[model samples]
Target: MSDTPPILVVDDQEKLLRLVVMLMNRIGFPEVEGVTSGPEALERLRERRYALVISDLEMEPMDGIALLREIRADDDLMNTPFILTEASFDFEDINVAHQAGADAFILKPFDMAVLKTKLKQVLNSKPRKREAPVAAESSLSNDFPMLGKF
Candidate 1:
């Protein structure tokens, strides 16, 4: 962990991504990176470690749920905190995000204060332990069967 607080913001919407980056910067998280897709997010994760990953739930190619699943599957990245955001907080979506190993959930169109508070909470929380390989494999293979097909 470097002294700088690095964060990854993953969202397909360019406007949202820029807004998040700006907000995070204003909140003292200067070292932030943004990506427009799950694959790009994963690539960024591979290249460097981030204190937290804030992702939008709905996206083209790989959605946030599938991205969360993939992140949890990788031992090196599994323990990293993931904050999922969606425009709506339907029970099914929340449950699926939790099941996929999301550390926190944020609703879209959120106030900057709410996002800042949640980010602080997650960053202050204890580091997570990597899930067992068997569990990770199951999570990746079972939860979103429709993932790769898209």
Candidate 2:
């Protein structure tokens, strides 16, 4: 993991956060960091550079969409790759995340293989900017082949 970039994961649920961190480690990302809130995520982002950020969609004070927007607004962090994860499929929420510059979206209860795919896709792609909303279902299916299973 010395040559690999670190990953940051944000989820308010402690158990979920730890689970994700563990899965990321198991999937070849040994330098995974977990934070409990968006504010803490922002603090970490400002403090260090990360290869990617995977955040839960429903956190308080600052949800994933809000955090993405904040990251996009900042010139220094505007190009950071981000993946937003939600427990349930909500079209409106997904659309908002797209508009906020999320690199990818994953529905929760995902296995390690699904997470590995998303991490690879996001990390290999160029940085993205906030864009107009698109058809959420089509966008999700195109990006995540296993999305229909959830």
Candidate 3:
């Protein structure tokens, strides 16, 4: 990762995306890229590797929850740090995000300090070895096909 690893920020709002990119750059993450939708983000994810992915929880077509689930399902992207940002905080949303392997969750109207802190926490996190669950409750495949076992 060159100096700072590249970050991919996904948000439907163009202004928010721009602002996030600016803030990330100012905070020493110069190699930041923004996408307007989950599909677009997935395309980019296929093309390159990113140190982190910060996505808005609400978006057209595929929302952050769907995106996060897909990311978690893929073995290659499963360990990548994912941060979900939303304007409103919901406990159900938080639970799902955490279960989906999200590293951090941030609120909208981004806080530079909080963002920085979360970035550190996520980056410093050790890689988790992908191990199959021994218990039935550990598998989320029964509900979410994307999160199913191989």
TM-scores for all candidates: the values are 0.83, 0.85, 0.84
Q: Report, for every candidate in turn, its global Cα lDDT versus the true structure.
A: 0.82, 0.84, 0.82
Question: Which model, 1 or 2, shows the larger TM-score?
Answer: 2
lDDT (Cα, tens digit) per residue for candidate 1, span 86-141? 88767678657867787777777878887887787778877666544335435443
* Residue pairs with backbone overlap in model 2: none
Prediction RMSDs, each to the true structure:
7.5, 3.3, 6.9
Instruction: Mark the regions of model 3 whose C-alpha exceeds 4 Å error after superposition.
Output: 1-3, 132-150
User: What value does the lDDT take at residue 29 in candidate 3?
Assistant: 90
lDDT tens digits, residue span 1-150, model 3: 477668999999999999999999999998999999999998898888899999999899999989988888888887778989998767677657767777777877878888898888888887866686334345444422334463
Give the clashing residue pairs of candidate 1, or none.
none
- Per-residue lDDT for 127 in model 1? 63
Worst 10 residues of 1 by lDDT: 141-150
Best by the lDDT measure: 2
Candidate 2 lDDT (Cα, 0 to 1): 0.84
- Clashing residue pairs, candidate 3? none
* Per-prediction tally of clashes: 0, 0, 0
- For candidate 2, lDDT tens digit of each residue in 47-79? 989889999999998988899999999888988
